[model samples]
Target: MSERKVRVIVAKPGLDGHDRGAKVVARALRDAGMEVIYTGLRQTPEQIVQTAIQEDADAIGISILSGAHEYYFGRIIELLKERKASDILVFGGGVIPEDDVPKLKAMGAGAIFGPGTPTSVCIDWLNSAVREKWARETA
Candidate 1:
């Protein structure tokens, strides 16, 4: 049987109007064989989570450059939990500081790719992580 393609929702939360990086990563993920949905810029945390759930996404890749990574990440994860959809893995990227990475992860973000992180790195991690999540869910 053919394997299912991982579906991802790529979103830019808050007032961050710059989406070049998010667009790059979205294209890269699509090229890498995942089904990517780009939510465009200035998305709210609620809208992102709702879209992910509606699309039955395997993961969410949020690109935030507005220095509100903490709030965005936390709110999204919290919404996922409240909606009983915590299995939708959440990751982020953009101009986040290295020091904030751990805090983001601690708040339920699966990963945080800072500036200069390669798209291949994110793709590979998503493939592996989503596979594991599926395995755990099915088991």
Candidate 2:
């Protein structure tokens, strides 16, 4: 099989207008050789999932910093499931509380990289996880 590039959609959902970190991470992922589609700020969960599907994305990485992590992330996951797009790896980062990371993960998020997490770490995880998920799917 030919090598396929991983495509990721980095989105900012809900009322969160902060996007410096999202833009930074988008550049980091692009520099790391991945296709990154930044959807800008104030996207709804429905819009995010639709973009992911339309782009044929390998992953969705949300950046939320408005302290509405649970509500937004949960809604995104639900929308992904509703669209039968759960196979696309879902992860995120932001100023989330320590107590909420596990809950997010348990709700089907591939990983949650909180504030202060390195950009390199996010890139590595995306590269590795996408490969593993694709391998499993194609096996």
Candidate 3:
């Protein structure tokens, strides 16, 4: 079988209208050689997870700045679990509180990126994480 590029879904959830960060991250991820599907603005958790599954995404990156990280990320994780899509690596960024990082991680978020995060840092982490998962699955 031929090798496939890592597919990622970048989504913006809730009533937050700020998408500049999401767009930036999407572009960065795309430039890093991953297939990115941006779910646009104001997506529900269910919609985001559904899109990820439909797109057969290997990873999901959510950008949220509405201070509802817990609810949004938690709901997304729960939905992914319910759908048995937990194998898909999930991450969150944008104004996340440092204190909540452990909580979100415990709920299945692979990582949380806060403001001023270097794009390369996230890109490298994603590449490594996806590569490792793919290797494990294909092994």
Rank by lDDT (best first): 1, 3, 2
Predicted structure with the largest lDDT when compared to the true one: 1
Model 3 TM-score on a 0 to 1 scale: 0.96
**Each prediction's TM-score against the native?**
0.97, 0.95, 0.96
Candidate 1: misplaced stretches above 4 Å?
A: none
What tens digits encode model 2's per-residue C-alpha lDDT throughout 68-88? 989888998899899998889
**How far does residue 112 in candidate 1 sit from its true spot (Å)?**
0.8
Of candidate 2, the 10-residue stretch with the lowest lDDT total is 108-117
Which has the better TM-score: candidate 2, or candidate 3?
3
- Write one digit per residue (lDDT tens) for candidate 3, span 1-139: 9668989999999999999999999999889888999899999998999999999999999999999999998999999999998999999799987999999999989999999999999999999999998998899
| Model 2 misplaced regions, further than 4 Å | none
Global CA lDDT computed for model 1: 0.94
Worst 10 residues of 3 by lDDT: 1-10
Judge candidate 1 at residue 44 and give its lDDT: 89
lDDT of 1 by residue, 1-139 (tens): 9978899999999987999999999999999999999888888899999999999999999998889999999999999999999999999899999999999989999999988988889998999999999999999
Q: Please state the error at residue 79 of candidate 2 in Å.
A: 1.2
